[model samples]
Target: METVSLTINGKKIVTEKGKRVLWAALENGIFIPHLCAIEENPLPFGSCRLCFVEIEGKKEPVASCTEEVTDGMIVDTRTESVLRLVRMAFKLIMSRHPIICRECPANKKCALQDISREMGFKLKPKRLPQILPDLPVDDSHSLFTYNPNLCVLCGLCVYICNEIVKEAILDFNFRGFITKVGTFKNRPLAESKCNSCLKCVEACPVGALSRK
Candidate 1:
């Protein structure tokens, strides 16, 4: 409940103490590009790297979605180093993302697609591995399908299902690079207590989870 004042993008703003930099920036009307931090969800899941910002007194750049705002803090929402890092992060995220923009239903409406174009990533990176793994597509559920390959591991779906819906149906199955979101016992979502809620599908920024 405590309040603090900070300078973000040269604008003075007051926010509650311990508020994440992302929430403070948004509340103050400073739009920093972000994908994984949804307002209704508490889990930050700062994997996107799109909300990186330069904060004074910090050695390296920190993720706005995860960094807590401090009093009298000087935060640069857009800087040369921050832009470079963001652009690179965009490229990396796009590398594994499916290139179904022209043929897929989401297409222009896709958040990832829109963000990539906005960031001026015209061509995909060639240095990164071209061979992407194929994850199972779960179509048994009447409402949605689970395609782990397209997932950016943003955890938005997991958060929505567990935190918002209170279903606790989906979760990460493994660890490290092999990790993928799945239901308990790796059963189909239809077999779980999912309640056929489409909140998870709606929360997914990418086509990793979609309504069928």
Candidate 2:
């Protein structure tokens, strides 16, 4: 494994080459908020924008969860502008998300819930439209149910399903805003040979997939 030297939060740290900025920051005792990246899982699902960081030589802020570290890299984990952007991103995520945290099974434990609280969004934004389309629910599976309306297109479900489970049961079905993760035939998740593993449900950071 190749090692790279990088500065995170003004602290010099060394990490292996190809290691993501998130890991490097973590290894250096610098915590950057994140939702989709997990230790047991190396796949960087940068759907949650909480991990945005400013690099000295980078043109734009990059998602730390996906951007790999390089030698002599300078990373800023906290800044006024970066904090503002993160707060805005958090607000946007919370706006479209259902206010089920109080009653959600994952309530206190949910990544989205924790991040929302950390960002100090005391009141939900009113700008986001509440017109959520009713998607067909799939409850035939024993382990979990599929709720498309709550999905944030994080892609963790598809990533875990395909990469970890080695089962290509879920994928994007359309393009742009219409894009949805679903079974290959567009059939209900229950009908697919999903094995009822519930890995997708575990990997999802939002209420999109859950065990009811």
Candidate 3:
């Protein structure tokens, strides 16, 4: 792999030529808030919109996951514009995810909790009303539980299930505010052809999918 050098947050770092800014910064010990970023997936959709970064000469911040690094590139991960976008993205994601962590399986082990602690953001955004899907918990799998109400719709579970695990059992169902990860025809996991690989549960950042 061809290597290139770039500057991120005043620190010069060298990385592979085609690496995305997100991976480059992360590998070099720079933390830019992100979700819905899977290194294996080449075509990132930037859905979470939390990895925004200010690049030199760019009019607006760009999602680092979808932006490839270039030699001698200058990147600022915490500019005013970057923070505005990241804070809003975090707020929007948290608006949909329930903040009741005490009873959740992930609890201290959740990614949202980590992001909250790292970014100094609240788990529940004030003024932004929570719009939970209020879907029923699917405990029929016998190995894990699926709680749609707590899902942040980061698409990690769906991508892992369909792309990595090749289970093809989970995807975004419905659209817009009502969207959620579900089986085809909205059937329960018990009726679907799930192999119980549990990759989806492991990929879940929040507690939407958790082991029993």
Candidate 4:
């Protein structure tokens, strides 16, 4: 494993070459607001662009989840532009997520909630448009519930089930804004090959997937 040196927030740090900027900052106790970035998942989801970082010589803030560390890199994780991008991303995520945090089961443990507080942003919609049409809660499984309304479409479950678990039961159902996770033919998860392993439930960052 090759090593590279980079500067994050004016602190010089050395990391393995090809390490994702988000994980590198996190391992060193430097917080970079992010969601949909599971260390176990290899591919970058990039659905939530909250991990944007301003790198020297680069005109725009790059998605830290997809950017690899390089030698002599000057990375600014809290630049004005980077903060603006991250704040907007959190706002967009909250617009679709229900604002009634007090009643939510994952309120205290929610990554979205923690990151919003850290970034000094409110979870209120703030005029950002809502996403996905109304979706019914799939309570077919006795142990778990699936609510598409709270889903951020991070695809962590899809990746885990399809790639990691090799279950091939769960996947995105539609294209673009209409996309939603489901079993083939929209069948109930209990009726599908879910096996009730709860891997998908664990991968979900929001209360979209939860144990009943």
**Number of the top lDDT candidate:** 3
Best by TM-score: 3
Candidate 3 has its poorest 10 consecutive residues by lDDT at 130-139
Query: Once superposed on the true structure, which residue ranges of model 4 sit more than 4 Å away at CA?
Result: 129-133
Q: Which stretches of candidate 3 lie over 4 Å from their true place?
A: none
Per-residue lDDT for 99 in model 2?
Answer: 72
Estimate, for each residue in 128-183, the C-alpha lDDT of model 4 and write its tens digit: 87553577888899899998878888888999898889999898987765678999
Can you rank all candidates by TM-score, best first? 3, 4, 1, 2
Query: How many steric overlaps are in each model, in order?
Result: 0, 0, 0, 0
| C-alpha lDDT (0 to 100) for residue 127 of candidate 3 | 83
Give the alpha carbon lDDT tens digit for every residue of 54-100 in model 3: 99989999999999999999999989888888888889888877788
lDDT of each: 0.80, 0.77, 0.88, 0.84
For model 2, how does the per-residue alpha-carbon lDDT over 92-160 read when each residue is reduced to its tens digit?
766656676676666666676666566655436556655444566666777887777677777888888
- Cα displacement (angstroms), candidate 1, residue 146, comes to 2.0
Candidate 4 has an lDDT of 0.84
Q: How well does candidate 1 score on lDDT at residue 163? A: 86
The TM-score that candidate 1 achieves is 0.83
